[model samples]
Target: MTMSFSPQVLLSKVARERCIANIKELPKFALNDEGSKKTYASVLVPLCVVKEEVCLLYTLRSSNLKNHSGQVSFPGGKIDEGETEIDAVLRETHEEIGFNARDVEIWEKMPIIQGRNKEMIIHPIVGVLNNMNVDNLVRSVDEVEDIFTVPMKELCNIENHGHLKLQREKIILPVYTFGKYTIWGITGMITHLFLQCFLPESLYTNDFMRKKYTIGELMPSKI
Candidate 1:
């Protein structure tokens, strides 16, 4: 089915309200540890017009990076001292891809996603970009190997989704593979959460749900 959502639609009042309302209904995870100190970070789920269609931007991390090297991820990083989550997301996006903060319109703040190490808390901030062209992105070669976009229609396709079985607790993860890039782990989790804002409730069953905990419960808490 063809989805009619566009960068403009994502910024519409109706869409924003629906997204926020859905987020409230969804379950939010928190860290399981009682005393483990947590490192906070933030990422921008950037939506922009690509080829006259709405698409989400993703980055290929440089292979030389120490963490999650050479992996596909959103433009983001660790929150700086005394900085808010929104500030961190904007700063990281600029530092990674040279995307100006003035061109972005913040829309939604997704639930916090905890890293596998159980000590890092990531805040996913959703936003729409203005006057963005993939070809014009000034990628930071030191941190980003490349930048790409996936249309909303392709992202919503059921055919593009899959699952990976875990070794512990029989946990399963929802995976999305686009071309040669495999989006899994925390990135996959964030993608799945964002999809919830647009996809029908029924589409999130069986392979998409990951486990009995529902898609939202797949990630543990960070609070």
Candidate 2:
């Protein structure tokens, strides 16, 4: 049977305090047990107020790019020598989305993540984009093909969430599908991490939650 999306689920709202408090005790990401030998990079997990709701910002890389062509990603790039995590994310955000450093309020530096598909240590920074107008932002023609946003409520909808399981490897990854974008790979993992802190248990649940519950009962998005 094709289960229907619940209309009674409460919408999840993004809270700065909630995010800060929730993630402190969480363990940092391991590099799939891979030893240190990867490039260092930084990406911004930008949250902005769109249409009176908190939305996540993302970019579709230009298909012409040398790496991860046409993939959906946050605004970021390799960290230059002597560059701190904040410096790299701010510079990349400005370059990719035309968001000024003054407009972004740095919130917290998330646990370190090393990409399995690529040899790179990614430092993900959570920042609040103030007075951001998606329409007014420019996408770099060279690196970014398109820029878009997804509301927190829409992302928390259980029907839109699933998993990617590797039978032989016994690996599981969270998946989120929003509109035409299918978030998987390392990007999918990052999105799941954000939702973990952004939404309450009543709204967002993932593989990490050991308790079993009906999907209908967990569908908390009003969208």
Query: TM-scores, in order shown?
Result: 0.85, 0.81
Q: Best-fitting candidate, measured by TM-score?
A: 1
Best by lDDT: 1
Candidate 1 residue-wise lDDT, 100-166, digit = tens: 9999988878888778788998899988878997777899989998898987777766666777666
TM-score attained by model 2: 0.81
Query: How many clashes in each structure?
Result: 5, 0
The alpha-carbon root-mean-square deviation between model 2 and the true structure, to one decimal in Å, is: 8.0
lDDT of each residue in 79-135, candidate 2, tens digit only: 999999999999999999899989998888888887865477898888888899988
Count residue pairs with overlapping backbones in model 2: 0
